[model samples]
Target: MAYKITDECISCGACEADCPVGAISAGDDKYVIDADTCIDCGACAGTCPVGAPVEA
Candidate 1:
């Protein structure tokens, strides 16, 4: 499953750099993970300070 970024995201851009597939992007309100491009590696989740990334 792909990972989803929750509203708790701080948009600090840490997760974006951790995403191996470049699935994470900056959104209007927060960082978003492109489900189609995500590899489900959980790298972004590990890097998120607010625990915004979760399995979807």
Candidate 2:
């Protein structure tokens, strides 16, 4: 499964830059993951300060 950014995301851009597959991007209120592009590597989750990235 791909990782999804929760409402807890603070729009810090940490996850976006850390995503190895370039699946994460800035959204209206938070970061969002491109399910089709995500590789499930957990890089975003590992780098997120608020633990916003979670398995979907």
**Which 10 consecutive positions of candidate 1 have the poorest summed lDDT?**
16-25
Candidate 1: give the clashing pairs: none
Q: How much does each candidate deviate from the true structure in C-alpha RMSD?
A: 0.5, 0.5
* TM-score of structure candidate 1: 0.96
In order of listing, the candidates' clash counts read: 0, 0
In lDDT terms, how accurate is model 1? 0.94
- The per-model lDDT (C-alpha) reads 0.94, 0.92
lDDT of 1 by residue, 1-56 (tens): 99999999988999999888899999999999899999999999898889999999
- The whole-model C-alpha lDDT of candidate 2 against the native structure comes to 0.92
Instruction: Please give the TM-score that candidate 2 achieves against the real structure.
Output: 0.96
lDDT of 2 by residue, 1-56 (tens): 99899999999999999888888888898889999999999999899899999999
